[model samples]
Target: MIVRTIRVRTIWSVCVPLPLLSLMLVVFGLTTGEFVIAGILPDVAAGLAVPVPAAGRLVTAYALGMIVGGPVVTALTARLPRRPLVTGLVAVSVLANLGSAVAPGYGLLLAARFAAGLVVATFFAVAIATAVSTAPEGRQASAVAKVALGMNLGIVLGTPLGTLVGQHLGWRAAFAAVAALTAAGLLMVLRFVPASPAPTGSMRGELRVFKGRDVQLALALTAVGNVGVVTVFSYIAPLLTGVGGFGEGAVPALLLLYGAGAVAGNFLGGRLADRALMPSLAGLLAVLAAVLVLFWAAGGVRILAVPLVFVLGLLAFAIIPGMQTRVLTAAGAAPTLAVAVNASGFQTAAAFAGWLGGAVIDHGPGLRSLYLVGAALTAAGLGIALYVLRRDRRPSPEPGRRPEHAGT
Candidate 1:
């Protein structure tokens, strides 16, 4: 028994990292392809004969697709095999990115981006579900963190990767590379990822999760918290350079520091959630709220801005895995759809935040207002979480150890 246990542990240690890498690659491909368009906005506007602001609408269109597609796909595909569905979605993403590269006009590019958004939303939820399901008992947060790691890496790596490709070869070349990466992710999923049984539930049964007070509160908190963070981050470059007076070269370094902090946050958050789920959530949200406020206060000091950005990244990311864990815990066994819904909620709220931030900035509001908005939203999230924690009072379920639903 001991020898067998050791063998199993060895295999899992090796095998699990493969999934993490593959998941990261998937996020990388999606993010690189999607955000690359932002950098090429000028080129695309000129190519398609549209005004710059109108070209920006393409991004808005893609986000709209993401917000609408995620839950719709989850609800529709509730009965499809999880692993295969993920593979298929990624395959489609590759095709979409490829299409974006060769698209003839703005309308076609918009269509391609919409298609990519559809695939990305589905890809995210599936990846998270697979990670959580595969995690060992008491390690679900870590597993989900692996997916979060992919997300952070994407933000850190994607734009640069896209820029390099576009600079050397053109924006078309960048999209092609992202397509190739997506294809690679698909192959990895097919080759290494084991099949997962479909989540069992009617759409109605899944919707019941919304009826749960904790789930509703959790979803609300996620939306508000996401908006809060994005509000400030949307204007981070301006804040750092204009207000903090950091050089352009320093911006990339600062972003790297933030990425490192995020990695640390993900790992630490999982451990903290494992220790005491509710308190971890509360503490992280509170710190996140405070960090945004500090960013507002520290705007004039470069030294302060650097450390504050790091703390902001840490606090913002720490909430993700814990929030995810919270939903799974409260939802009990059948969490697949609920988890998907939460992902959608985050995306939707981010859209609202981007709009809100833009509105604030448009009014000649300084970058500090971004932090103010973030702080307010984060406080709201923390308040909701606190209320839920107080109401539940029951200890959170152990991470990675989910109860089986009736069908499972």
Candidate 2:
């Protein structure tokens, strides 16, 4: 029976990580919904009998829901047990996807997407905060990495999987698949995650973190970074086909390679952040800027697309854990609200990027300009990081001003 016991132990090891993975799946659902337009825009337009551009507005509505829900729900549920709150949010997400799958008209599907985005916002905020709070201090990066894997998972799997489902099934089938995944994820969250202790704080107390410059800078950095990345990434399929001359079938393979690279970068990023948080961040942003420029140059070469996509994925995602660490560090003791707000900022940035990308596509500049825009935004974020680093290097102004309260 020793062999049987060992197998059980191995299974537990795998199961222990399920709660974290479940959160990522929730993220995957959100990301998939956000990106569904990429593959299903035509189908949705055809189905709804609306213009493709009008169908794209569904993405906008979804992002708006996420942006609005993140901080509002975090603030409202500050005292709720995170596990239950998160599980409930996932349930909402499942319902939203189900609604999208069954909706009779374009307007109803649009509304459903917005509702799903709302749950996405709240779930992301609570999950990240609780994961960080429960983690052992030194292992915070690893803990955060577990959850951040959701972003990578969403990036790697969400689009391709959603597209595949849409292709084999129907556009509505895409939402049906998302709904099924959400149900599975919610069940896992309920079964595997331990109860989260409620925080003892007023909304005012949690809001105090915003008064700190470092916190503000960190939020700005997140917003800028996300906007930059999504601006270009929102049109990735188009870029591959229009510029890279890749066939439709080849896009998913390229995305999968990028996802694999992101997973590797995420581990390295977490480790390096644990070792040297700030410098690792600086180097990462630098790499991000470089990668965007390289992407622009190689946008047309199918042969070079693989390595460039890998590098782009790596540099873009590697910054996530460190950024989370930075924010938590700056937010002082109560990190839940800060984490939630960070998510809000990220979603807002996503909304901005989507709108910007759509505008570029509409105004006749073509998809290639997205890379230029993304590169510029990355450079701006890098500049912000460098400024923070420079200021951190200086001595405190007063005996009281000694940077002790600085968090992220």
Candidate 3:
């Protein structure tokens, strides 16, 4: 049953095979592209002569591209060699980010952002599959976790550092740097990522998995269950600046704190999900709703707001492992397509987050109202989660290890 000799120790292991390490770096670049925009929204708005709320739509556009692009790209390229397809996707991202850096107008920059996002989910699906295919028997979970660590690192390191670049330099420079990162990743992929046979599964069989009710619930939970956190995070820059009275300079530091919380949460979440998937999700969502409420009430106080940012990060990331476990368990038969669907659903929530946060800021109560809005949305998701839990009649799917998210 052995595919090769690759070994991924655990969630905390540092030593990984070069191919997986290369894929990790590539994912870091992709996730940073998704996350850094949040930190630089105010700067991008000013640079492009648009409103901050309007700048938020750049995020929506990128997410919409991912939603549309993942399935189409995967379907079109399913039978192609894995290594070259992965490389081509990263190459596309590099070009798109370069376009973002040089575009003179807001419209063109938005287009560039969308193009950059198109390759993200497809890369993740292929990259994870590549990691799995190359792993020793009984270690697919470790392989998935290793790639997911790239995403966590993107949140913890990439966003804060990228924010610093955008803050000190021009926002355009930030995109350029991401392009450079991916360019480096492309070279490493060429050197390290081994060639693999094209996927043999048909699109018909993959589509068939979605007809299951369990799969349907899992996808809905992914889109709905996570929207609240995504909402607050989308406008986090303005909230901290306007409400917490921090200067734009302070946003990176706060995001760093949030990132630190996310790292801690990622490990804690995996352990919990491995033990009791549904119960843990229900508990995490309930706490997430409470945390959002707390954020709404105390967001203005500088002292409280600081710690609350960390807590919000903790609770938000904590729910991801359980949700991912749900999807992998429900549709493990077509993991690549299953992962693609879940990734799109994850981006769908992010897209909604940009729209809903902008709507709240522009027309509703105000920036602070975003927290309450998030709380309500999370409560709705929690209700949906509880209904799914109550109607359960079978064992929760055990996907060996916690399949940490690439979409966060």
Backbone clashes in model 3: 0
Q: Write candidate 1's Cα lDDT for 115-187 as tens digits.
A: 8887676777778778877778888887888777767776777777777777778777878888998788778
lDDT for position 25 in model 3: 91
- Write model 3 residue lDDT over 1-408, tens digit each, in one string: 133323334332355677888888988988898889987999999998999988988987888889988788777777788877887899999999999999999999999989988878888888777776677754554566567768889878888789899999989999999999988887888898887777677778777888877788888887888998899998999999998888899997898888878866765676676667777788889998998898888888889999999988888887776676677777767666667768988987787788889999999999998898899988988987887787574454467753322112
lDDT, candidate 1, at 88: 76
Residue 184's lDDT within candidate 1 is 86
Compared with the true structure, model 3 gives a TM-score of 0.79
Instruction: Show the colliding residue pairs in model 1.
Output: 138-399, 140-400
Off by over 4 Å in 3: 1-19, 35-60, 101-110, 131-145, 163-173, 190-195, 241-250, 361-369, 391-408
- The estimated TM-scores of all candidates read 0.89, 0.86, 0.79
The true-versus-predicted C-alpha distance at residue 322 of model 3, in Å, is 2.8
Give, for candidate 2, the lowest lDDT window spanning 10 residues. 399-408
Could you give candidate 2's per-residue lDDT for residues 376-407 as a string of tens digits? 89888888888878877877777656566465
